[model samples]
Target: MSGRPVVEVIDPGIQSTVQAWPGRTGLLAQGYFPSGPMDHLCFRASNVLVGNPPGAPALEIDKIAMSVAFLEDTQIALAGPEGIHARLNDVPVPIWETVRVRPGDVLRTANPGRPGYRLYLAVRGGLDVFEALGSAATSLITGIGGVEGRSLLRGDVLSALPRDPVSARRFPEALRPRFTTEWELEILAGPRSAPDFLTDQDWSELVSLPWRVDLNSDRVGTRLHPHRFRWANGGSIVTGGHPSNVLDDAYPVGGLLANGDVLTILGMDGNTSGGFAVIATVPHCALWKVGQVRPGRDTIRFRAVTYDEATALNRQVDFTIDPGRVQVL
Candidate 1:
């Protein structure tokens, strides 16, 4: 408690893991995924509230009950789309603000008011965890980064770097994000998503209707229903047995894949390379919203935008809240 801050996990909850900046550059070719927080915006905001750098390591949790015991005195912040019920030592603790914690403080989190999927917790100096490929993100598929390269388990213990306390802080109401169930995503057609991949008629249908979120969705990707498309006559060759399969290639974070009859939009822990065809890529500016789209509850419709328009929206969103704390990509 004197030299380093620590937290003991009584119940790690669902899919909780320590996440930092994504894997190092040029790592995908070697099959390493940049498995950072799915909601980077909230992750950075939590760190900022604690006076830490934007990319400092933090705990990311899904919508599940969790409890932890603080073994040292420090400052911590929780940031997310909706304020979940939390208590310290049986007293209600506020969200979106840094709160001081002392030894033996029992912190519990649960009862989400909304449908979003992620909640982030950031300590003042960041979590102290092993880094793989120059990142602290935990890849559940690869078992490579974070604590033992897996999700937090019961009785797990986590620590933060030793540092003098920063001032307790909170973000103004106007700066926090409000989540919704119906999402309209602006997309940019990727290299593989040229006009010829799908017929003009199919492209129209893709943008015109709301795609249903499937229950199979997870951190790896969000599976969607009704992604079938018409192929242009002789427009392209069949890359594999399935019409959607192509030569395995690198996939962007928001790559929309035509896997069989359904589709999947890649997430933070998505594969670095795959055989499916990516019809579009979500811009970094609005990519975090993908993480909040609760499976079987929220639906999304894509709106194709020009490259210029995508860049402009990116800048606008970044400046609207805590400017200079987040990057466009």
Candidate 2:
């Protein structure tokens, strides 16, 4: 087998895209959204396992079922919730650890055995893709970065950066995230809520029940069922017809847009600004769970927290993954 450095996409499976650390930044005010990997925890873990610096560009596969042919020998790794079925040259491959791929070898991933939605694969030197807006992440909505800004399709080919050989490694089992159907996200009170836009009763109901994910969800955002909320003013003073509409303003990373009984959480590829009222915001640390939730199967609950607490959680998550060293960013 030749040691040439190329990968051929045999099948794109689902919404497979190239993602990197911190994605697109410093452009949200200009109507640009960061289109990086949905699950940062898994994405970073995969990169570290393959000897790439944390936040290195990698493949973020949605719903599994992708196939590729390696034209060169290299080291790779996969990281995500348990239950993914992956194989190299028809032999089963383990997740969370680095493995060697020989030239002309076929690598394929089947249905994920668990409930999560996104999975990550990282090569030793990171995938070679054009960087747009200082990132290689693909935004399906804007079509801006990473492989012409879309998911991988049949016949797609990717190049790997040249690097000195590195020893294979695995992340500690205790540090890996466990996948589950139920999720509890810690949220902070939104800017609009400070003026009492929502009543006390509304907040109680929001956290009291588990909400199912709608099938119509996408990279831009996902809708939750049974919104069960109204303006505190009892439907008076309509905010531009729909109860959710408000003056357009810059949106946060995880804006909770509400329109009467319907609610949608802004995701990594969400719009920069909108007319919807943001009822609450999910901190950066909890966003990984939002990306891994499966539509029509997963459910979510939000618990309110202070901004300080949210920031602390972010640091905690980072320390849990890579404690003793600074990220290369």
Best by lDDT: 2
- For model 1, residues 168-244, the per-residue Cα lDDT tens digits are 67677776777888888888886566465666786788788899888888889988986557755332365666666
Q: Which pairs in model 1 have colliding backbones? A: none
Clash number for model 1?
0
lDDT of 1: 0.79
User: What TM-score do all the candidates reach, one by one?
Assistant: 0.91, 0.93
Provide the global lDDT of candidate 2 against the true structure.
Answer: 0.81
Residue 170, model 2, lDDT: 69
Candidate 2, residues 146-174, lDDT tens digits: the string is 78988899998888787776766767767
Measured by TM-score, how close is model 1 to the native structure? Answer: 0.91
